[model samples]
Target: MEKRLTHFSSGSGCGCKIHPAKLEEILKDVRSDVQSFPNLLVGNEASDDASVLKINDEWALVQTVDFFTPIVDDPYVFGQIAAANALSDVYAMGGKPLMANALLCWPVEELPAEQASKVLEGAKSVCDKASIPLAGGHSINIKEIAFGLSVTGTVHPQKILKNTGAVVGDVLFLTKPLGTGILSTALKRGKLNENGYEALLRVATELNTIGAELVAINGVHAVTDVTGFGLYGHLIEMCKASEVSAEVYFDKVPKIAEAVQYIQEFILPDNTFRNWNSYAQFIDCPLPETFAWLNDPQTNGGLLFAVAEHAVDTLLNTFQKHGTTQFLLEPIGRILPKDEKIIYVKR
Candidate 1:
């Protein structure tokens, strides 16, 4: 009998990531020593997506690795999501992907070994689309199934973009709608509608390759992918890192229609509450329950970019040229001077 991978995905996938606050506490003692490794442009200090090493006057190397358990039932689809998620960090750093190494942890006792190959095939599909190789990887026996990739890419040393650099007047934009975690939860519970499943698949598998092009757009200042941490969680990280605040428009933020209805019924993944508890203090919302999309953890989510007011048209045109299906190309918020509230979600 064929096994359904989603059945094993209880608290797995990106939703199973270490708690953001706890992760901070664990890494707080570790600091980036620029004096010893001056070429390390972005390291552990600011929690940037990837660590960049300046290789020469004209080029830099970007490295990032991400692996997660099954978020979908198909082994191949899970591989696709993992590959896209891993590559997004490189794109976020304004780099183009070159190659990838696979990571597989499987329950050798229960599932067939062929499922593992399907997972690699799925990842390779995305890698092929990105014009990269699935060079090699390491696998281990485990009780639960997980898969992902370690992506390497290159970018101009001066062109690297971090989660920081947002100015007071910068405009914020989200490439995709919110609520992958909620929809994944619905799928695991056999409650997801066909449209919701399609939405989840498209968003999760769509590569955020546009991030690599943002370096050419003068109006764009900062770039980061919204993943397991959710929209509010990642935006707060950007604000605190850039020493700025944000004014988010609650109504303007795009979302999945099915996810919107599910939230009304309070259907959500545990990661939603975990994300909320980590950064609840920074979020200011009167109708918090109505806006619970802020805390829904995403798996292989979209890119969250901050751009200047004058460059909005350039950024939109660039996005159009890329021809990727990301929702709501308009601004969802704007950067503000440091304020009492880190994020102000206005109705």
Candidate 2:
């Protein structure tokens, strides 16, 4: 019998992440004296992508770890998505991944070891594409089947990008369409088509390498990859860190075609509500259904970049030159001066 990987898990992909509010409360009491080490360029002080430690005057090391339950039925595709999602953190910080360590949790009594081997092979394939080594990792028997990577990468100290520099008047660009969470939910319900599955796999597995390239563009102010928290949550974090507000055009936001259908059908992950409950107080969206995409938890999602107004044309041109489709480089909104509202959604 063919075992469905998602069947054994409660949450799908990055949707398994704890609610942002709970996470903040959990980490609030934890003492992180990052200021004690001047070399810590970026730390837990801000909800940035990765922790960066300066190795020298020129280079800094970017470190991050992410793991989650399977979102796809195929173990190989799940592995690819998990690894790509983990590697996204380094890329989000404008860094090149150098190595990764696998993190796996298996249900020995429920599934066979062969399935786990396929998952490892899937991760190795992605690591090979990124030119990184899967150095090592640890595993354990758990109730759910989970897998991901702890990725390490390097970037120039001067060029390291963080989500803390978004400025008023900067334009926001989303590198990929929204709706992975919705589509994954549909998949779990056996409502997703083969085309939808292919779309999800393609988008999730594709590395957000554009972030690293944006480092050469001086106007690129802030870079953050949209993942578990969804667009609104991550944007809120950026606004708070940079002390800026955002004006997003709901109509302009790109979304996968299949996701739109699933959303219309009211198929959504459990985290959808949890995500909204965590940050709804800070966001001003007229329609409640807008949260379907705004707060929908994305797994290996796209990078949400803030670029200077004057450089928006250049950014688009660079993406075009790099063969990125116009659909993928959609301009969804702009940053605004800090105000009473952290996010303002224009319908």
RMSD of each: 1.3, 1.2
Model-by-model lDDT, in order?
A: 0.88, 0.90
Off by over 4 Å in 2: none
* Model 2: per-residue Cα lDDT over 1-347, one tens digit each: 88799999999999999888788898897645776888999888888889999999988999999999999989888899999999999999999999999999999888999999999999999999999999999999998889999999999999999999998999998988889999899999999998889889878898888877888897999999999899999999999999999999888888887787888888999998998888888988787768798988999999998999888778988899877887767689999999988999996
User: What TM-score against the true fold does each predicted structure earn?
Assistant: 0.97, 0.97
lDDT of 1 by residue, 1-347 (tens): 77788766567578989999889889988888878998988898887899899999999999999998789898889999999999999999999999999999998788988988999999999999999999999999988777889999999999998999999999999988888998989888888899999989988899988888899999788888899888988999999999999988878787877787788777889988898888878978776653468888888788898999999999888988988445677788999999988998886
lDDT of 2: 0.90
Cα distance off (Å), candidate 1, residue 138: 0.3
Question: Number of backbone collisions per candidate, in order?
Answer: 0, 0
Q: For model 2, give the 10-residue run with minimal summed lDDT.
A: 29-38
Q: Pairs clashing in candidate 2?
A: none
